[model samples]
Target: MKKISLYHTEIENKDGISGHVRSLTDDAFNQLTSSPLKSVPGTNPEQLLGAALATCLNATLEAEEKRRNLPHQAIVRVAVDMGRDYQGFQFWLRVQVKLPQVDQQEAQEILAICEQRCPVAKLLAKSQNVKIELVNEFGFKEEFK
Candidate 1:
């Protein structure tokens, strides 16, 4: 498939402790800094990564749901853990997706498709460990890795 879109962002960092990020969209400006425990108030790369993955995966799932005529409300929470690994720095993700309009089997199916379709999920899962939990209205839950 040919690429249809390209997104750009720039991060200005000096001391590795504080920085600013700018993307093509004017509303995408963000103040970047180390974790609160390590520095002053601001956002860190891990937080931004988690946020981006959550939003991107949610959008992908929304599109799939629309295409499949499966209307549902959902909340996706993504947690990113950053630490040192044998190869150097590494990160992992814990994602929980709550769906109000599907059963466990259906939710799992939808999430499986989303995992294959979401670009962020694809990229991250290639190099980072990603764990996803899907929950439905009946309280049924399933996990994927």
Candidate 2:
């Protein structure tokens, strides 16, 4: 099979978790980054990771919904927790998906399919720290391990 590049971009961060992050491919894509432990006005890696997964997974679900002739009403919520483990600091991501227009069984089916199709979800699929769930309603709160 031939490899084709559909989209590509680069991001740079010089200050680790306390300064700025900018995209090399897009001039308008610049933002401040800070540690979640601090009360600073910036975004952290955890939030960014959550945003990526939620956005990508929901976009995949949108495509599937379109294909099924349904309205785009899928919601994705990702909660990222950072903690210390045996190997030092580790991250856990809890991804919850809600398809309000469908039944529980069908929503679960769509979530399973989307998990295999979403690029970000697929990238994190093998990690034992990541979990994807189909939810009837979002609580938006979770106890981290």
Candidate 3:
């Protein structure tokens, strides 16, 4: 198999669970990161991962909507739960998608395609803890204990 690079970027985090994370490819991409266990004034890995999944999946959904000549009204929401497992700390992700412009069956089809196409979703597909759902409304439950 041949591999071709469509895009590449590097991100660096120098201070572990606290401090700053910045992208080497883009100077404007920088953010303060902190531990989720702390009440610090910064974003944590859980939020960041959720944001990435939501953004990437929504963008892929938007592309599919555009191809179908429908209004771009798809919404993607990701909820990440971090907890202790037998091995130590583990994370579970639940992604919900809403496509208001289409019927439930069509929405499910679109979501299926998006799941296969979305980069972030594909990356997380290997994990049994990751879930992708097609919903008419958003109602995320609390999973952390």
Candidate 4:
């Protein structure tokens, strides 16, 4: 097997409420809560997760189509619902994929392969816990232990 690539991002907060996320490419995004009443301006973690899953799934689907030489393109939308369960936090995702040039059966087959091929989807299927690092501006870092 070929070597895999590692993607990294750093989320830094001076206070506990708001912060910024910086990717390895130096792309910076402001991070904050999505509550309308408390309305802080920025993208929340849930939104980022949804975007990642949706993009990865769509890319996988396109790759599958290319392997099969099936001239098709898809519009993929993922809705991620985050709530609290008995174990604390739980996430539910609804993936809606629309393949315009293909029939329902072909679409189903593509979706099945995409689900298996998408790394994020496969990881989420097993309910794995991700390790997160909380770093303060004072250079103190804490990892989830």
Candidate 5:
């Protein structure tokens, strides 16, 4: 099954739809405005993408705790690092997991699995591209596709 669906919508009104997006799922909670700098405060498009990957890392680690069943002495923390450039953006999510009772091999395997399987991490590591489409709503003649 597909885990994510790419959503795109256009609005010309004041502030547009940037402020209207909310958590459609409990798993993915953080969202930010991607409009021009004049309209949004303290943010740009890259920051939002960083938040998405970080959120995924946290959620995946928490879920791994249950899946691994490491007794009562388990703790997990993930450090997400994001680097951006005009050329491209990349993420290096370092998952520092501590499990008291679990063996070293088991812990390593769990961390590796979580890091590789996390959806946002996968997207970022795979170098997903943003596809933009420009449409002219004011059609003088035929429709613009």
Candidate 6:
């Protein structure tokens, strides 16, 4: 088997990590995020979770669209709600994925893929490594990528 690597690029300005995202295929991408730390300008972890789910759903949808030759673009809109818990802030995401000409059974199947394959959804569900790192208004912070 051949090892494949996909490349994507982003730049940070006054507003955190925001730039173009690309892959082996697809020309669908826009401004990535805004630092929620107010000082940092990029989105926080919770927003990242939502973005992760959306990314995975979009990726999966792209593959399916190509396979089925569907007309019009299939969109996967994901919304993540945040709240406090015993551990920390917990995110409740509602993935209202919309696609054309898909039945309930098919919708369920796509959702299953998003739920299982979306890295953030799986990570949140698995509860393997859940932690929060606090930083100052504009202080340096680091973690495992």
Highest TM-score model number: 3
lDDT of 2: 0.92
> By TM-score, highest first, what's the ranking?
3, 2, 1, 4, 6, 5
TM-score of 6: 0.51
Go through the candidates in order and give the clash count of each: 0, 0, 0, 0, 0, 7
TM-score for all models, in order of appearance: 0.76, 0.94, 0.95, 0.67, 0.43, 0.51
Candidate 1: tens digits of C-alpha lDDT, residues 1-145:
9976686555555646565554445565657576634757778888888998889999988997888898847678887777677887777778889867887888888889998999888887766487778854223233322
TM-score of 2: 0.94
Per-residue lDDT of candidate 4, residues 58-122 (tens digit): 78878988888976476677655666689887666655677767767777777777777889878
Task: List the lowest-lDDT window of 10 residues for candidate 6.
Answer: 131-140
Pairs with backbone N, CA or C atoms under 3 Å apart (clashes), candidate 2: none
Tens digits of per-residue lDDT, candidate 2, 7-124, equal: 9899999999999999999898899999999998999999999999999999999999998999999999998999999988999998888899999988888888999999999999
Q: After TM-score superposition, what is the CA distance of residue 73 in candidate 1 from its true location, in Å?
A: 0.8
Clashing pairs in 4: none
lDDT of 5 at 110: 64
Q: Return the lDDT, model 3, position 56.
A: 97
- Which window of ten consecutive residues has the lowest lDDT sum in model 5? 130-139
**In angstroms, how far off is 41's CA in candidate 4?**
0.9
- Badly placed stretches (over 4 Å) of model 3 are none
The whole-model C-alpha lDDT of candidate 5 against the native structure comes to: 0.50
**lDDT comparison, 3 vs 4, better candidate:** 3
Error of 5 at 141 (Å): 57
Superposition error at 103 for model 2 (Å): 1.3
Q: Per-residue lDDT tens digits of candidate 5, residues 76-137?
A: 33333445678885544433445555667776676577768877656655444321111122
Residue 61 C-alpha lDDT in model 1: 87
Decoy 1 TM-score against native:
0.76
Write candidate 6's Cα lDDT for 9-75 as tens digits: 5533343355332332444533455435356444565676767767776786667666767653556
